[model samples]
Target: MADGTRIVDLEAVPEDGSYRLTAEDPFGNETELILVRCDGEPGVRAWSNTCPHESQSLDVGDGAAIRDGAIVCPRHGSHFDACSGECDDGPAAGTTLPGVDLAVADGAVHLADDRYAFLHEGGIDDDEPGSTSHLSL
Candidate 1:
């Protein structure tokens, strides 16, 4: 087990929101991940930013909605356990968010997932399609 890439200090994680970051997989695919405060030894939990129901990003630049120790999906109001990534409500019930391995040590969170390499501190900004909502007058 490698030490992994250090992403952020545990103390810097928001107590009520999420810390978003981007990572690249071995296949050169970029994935957005969100880190949320959790209860237990690690003190942090990470999950892919996509919602299972529609694959929409859980965070839309503000941060994923978090409540009662769960990550609330912004698209359809699904609630996923922060630590377990298990959705128990909304359209995504019974589904789990893809998890990214992490290591918490010396007060910092490290990206320990062997399948991915840390890319940046936010979502990918490129030609990928996004929201298609019509502009309001």
Candidate 2:
């Protein structure tokens, strides 16, 4: 993860829709992030593709449906708010999905590729369960 590299093209992602991309943080932890355009909105929202309940990648295809402005995980029927990442149902209900810090700048989506840079700098190990690590977006 460098300082000025673009993560994903915002134009490539459909407006009022969702897309998935795989990224590797500085520590080599690979994570899938889902970028979604909230209904009738211009900016994009992002969340970890991994479901907290079973650590399975949420279905990002047709299985990922938008209902009431939330992205629904098809595997366990969990609905997450596209803007806030709040789980609305299923086993992980009330649990919030991890947010991928990103922003639109210079007409492109800029994501902090090194999600665990802070943790590593703070002497934290990224491989440990429940470790404070960052997600690549």
Candidate 3:
């Protein structure tokens, strides 16, 4: 995906919070990728915004909720650690979000944009606004 696509300006993303960005996946599916800023880490973190349980975008526009430093999936309330993508609660208890490789450069979060942005065609309605998305581990 062009080496490293700039996702967002670092200052625009709140420390200890998250932001959702859109991209075209390697498979050509319009996808949503999430950018996370954690105080415990030196740089930004990222993941495919899809929750495994129902293949729903973990973020439903308002952004995924950060609870105790973890990402709480909006679909079924599953909480996944933003740092490690580990899930410890909800229907996706043993699964983790698929991680995306990221880097910090020139005051922005740059990602391998389409690296992890993939999902099966089934149930995905490309015609719906922002209905495009991801698939996490």
Candidate 4:
């Protein structure tokens, strides 16, 4: 679980809610993120704590709470829509959170290999042999 490998813990996550996780990137960069369960279903949303506007962690204060189906950032009072990671308020309006591609299977969270590339807005070559992106832990 510490090596960016796919590890799922379904039982540890509750349905119809959100959970915060501290993870590391493949380069060992620690990131605080949130996972939300919108509605009674098992859908999950993953986004980094770093706000796109100022690169500040959005997990601070009461900003992590779910409001109108989005996660609010405590620092500058920005609201990140969970489903789309778009900002709904403050100076960063129309911006988006760094989205982390994740899925739920067998009752655990699984980080997608290509998610980081999307978050970074980088392109992947077709000749690549393996996934170019990975979570550190």
On lDDT, the candidate that comes out on top is: 1
Deviation of model 4 at 107, angstroms: 1.9
Q: What local lDDT score does residue 133 receive in model 3, on the 0 to 100 scale?
A: 51
Candidate 2's residue-wise lDDT over 1-137, tens digit each?
Answer: 32444656677565545666655677677566667776433377767777777776663332246677787766788888888888868887988889877767766766654472222111122344323355556
Give the CA lDDT, 0 to 100, for residue 81 in model 2.
Answer: 83
Query: How many clashing residue pairs, candidate 3?
Result: 0
lDDT of 4 at 16: 34
Which order, best to worst by lDDT?
A: 1, 3, 2, 4
**Alpha-carbon deviation at 3 in model 4, angstroms:** 14
Give the TM-scores of the predictions, in the order they appear: 0.88, 0.69, 0.74, 0.63
lDDT accuracy of residue 38 in candidate 1: 88
Q: Worst ten-residue run, lDDT, model 1? A: 126-135
Q: Which residue pairs show backbone clashes in model 3? A: none
Tens-place lDDT digits, model 1, residues 1-137: 33999998888789888888889999999888989988865889889999989998988666788899999988789999988999988999999999888998888899999999998786676223332233457
The true-versus-predicted C-alpha distance at residue 122 of model 2, in Å, is: 31
Candidate 3 local distance difference test against the native: 0.69
101: Cα error in model 1, Å: 0.7
Point out where model 3 deviates above 4 Å. Answer: 1-3, 113-137
Q: State the local distance difference test value for candidate 1.
A: 0.85
Please write out the lDDT profile of model 3 over residues 1-137, one tens digit for every residue: 23576656788776555676666666676666777766555466777778878888866655678888888877788988888889988999999888778777777766754354423221234444444354446
Which candidate model has the greater lDDT, 3 or 4?
A: 3
Q: Give the Cα lDDT of each candidate.
A: 0.85, 0.62, 0.69, 0.58
Top-TM-score structure, candidate number: 1
